[model samples]
Target: MNITLPGKAATLMASQRERAEKQRARLGVEARSWYRISNAASDDEAEVMIYDEVGGWFGCTADDMIAELRQITAPRMRVRINSPGGSVFEGIAIANALRAHPASVTVQVDAVAASIASVIAMAGDRIEMAPNSMLMIHDASGLCMGNAADMEEMAELLDLISDNIADAYAARAGGTREQWRERMRAETWYLPEDAVENGLADEAVQAPKAGNAPPAPEEDDEPDMARAWDLAAYGYQGPRRDEPKTEEQQPLTINIGAAVGEDFVEQLRALVRQEVKDRTVAPASDATPTGPVAETEPVEPAPEPAAVPEPEVPAAEPVDAWAADIAGLLTTPADDWAADLTHLIGPDTSSRAAAEA
Candidate 1:
């Protein structure tokens, strides 16, 4: 039953109270006391709504819930809860009363079942959480102003209260008592899926009927501690992350070489050939001879030369070895010319090889 709390727990609770008061002032009411009961056409069935702070108001204890139930003799009942929990003792009392009631109880959370509210929800034979709803669990919170001995006693009392709360949660949830205690210590929050996964809720409620306007969401003045923790963990809106703005994102660009497919190669080659042809044709036209005729002189053609007789000559002697070698060298293939020159250089083989190397 022993528990350890953070050093700032007292400050956190005070801030929570202060914020809740602000919300009450803004809403122009205690922002609570939303409850109702309906007897269906069948006398043996009923539905009850618990849609605000638990434990009622001043001078109204847990007895209010019991009083409402006593008037209904229905054999089957539905309890709908959407509450920010108040008065853990009263919540526990209501839960116990529901547990003892002869009717089979089915609980549906329309919005949220948090803290002791979640404990009361566990009283149901079957529990359902709305797709958009949540459940939260944590150790009991309180304030104590006194001497060291008094403070020690209060701490011990808190631990005992926490253990009782854990017992309430562990009885219905998936995990063992110790594991639930650890989860409570961490101040866990559960989306509908999370609740189902952890056995806290039996199912997710179906979508509301068409043309039925959804209940307007309550203004959530999130407790500062919880707000800070959620922001650190799941961010502003639970698991969903805000998409990056267009201005925040870098523009995407594709590389031409990478993007061009094999089918484009022939088309690209044809384009290059057309460009080469245009360049070649433009310079050839510019290179055509251009001149102007004189104003006084007439255009004239050049005269052809007269024919002449061919001279007779005797045959010449054979060519010299050097001349013949020079002619042979000129006609030799470029690769063989180097070897021919090396041979013509009069066999200084070592020197030629050294030079070539």
Candidate 2:
């Protein structure tokens, strides 16, 4: 039977590397910390990280970072540091690995260590902070979210975090737990003297004065690129946006209102069609007539009353009647009569038989 041992080994190695990378991401954030490391030393007994400046993704030198760490063969680990802190959790992870080592660990700082760098400096058998340098410690922070229960749970998580950081400070520093809490609350910065007096730095070194002639530039000193993000708080809400969230891309209120109006109009039209269909589709139970059709002729039995009758009054005789009585003697009746003149005397009416010829 043939066994694919090499492939299996390769797969396992791949998985392990992937897990390491994932683990490294947990503490590296602007809202949190991202520690970069130059090298790590681990043997059967101990693990160590040597840091100059900061390490992790956003903080320090990355070239040969893994190789430098893996090269060490000491059973008891040593971490050499010179830094101004960049990422806190990355430093913590580095510290943790050393703690995990079976043998005691030692930290040797050539220069200054501040912020999280100070925290790392403390994770040692006897922290040997140079007198000319400093050690600074602050708070442990992370960003998270949830509902009621989730919020309480997150709160608990934060408490645990604060406890861990405080515990580290309390263990390594020459101060009470209350004093550590108060100092962190104030966001205090420490100088070399204060660091030493406070037990943050265990020793001192002499830094040379400036003004000596500088060395010539190296023939091969290409600038190293950086994996970078700005740090402002303990943690942030979510992943970093590559591009800014500009107003130009966001929908305006007017557009949102117009969309809602269009939806309402469509709904109204649909409702109208539905109602018309319902009206047209009458049920069999409603098909029967309610009554016979009513006659449309007007009712005329009560006719309007005749014009109001006037009160009785006598009529007066015409003035021409007397004249007609006198003219009757002189005139003979004619088949055709004309009133062209004053009759009884005028030739037009004077005895029409005489005038007729």
Q: Quick one: best lDDT, which candidate?
A: 1
User: In model 2, how large is the Cα lDDT of residue 218?
Assistant: 82
Q: What lDDT would each prediction earn against the true structure?
A: 0.71, 0.53
TM accuracy, model 2: 0.39
Over 4 Å off, model 1: 1-34, 56-59, 208-357
Cα-based TM-score, every candidate:
0.49, 0.39
Q: Which ten residues in a row have the lowest lDDT in candidate 1?
A: 262-271
In order, what is each prediction's RMSD in angstroms?
28.7, 36.4
Tens digits of per-residue lDDT, candidate 1, 92-193, equal 888998899899899999898988889889999999998799999988876666678768877787878888888877788756778888998999999999
Residue range 203-286, candidate 2, lDDT tens digits: 555566578977766866644344135333436556457877678867664332255454333333333333345556867785
- The worst-scoring run of ten residues by lDDT in candidate 2 lies at 338-347
Candidate 2's displacement at residue 322, Å, is: 99
Clashes of each: 0, 17
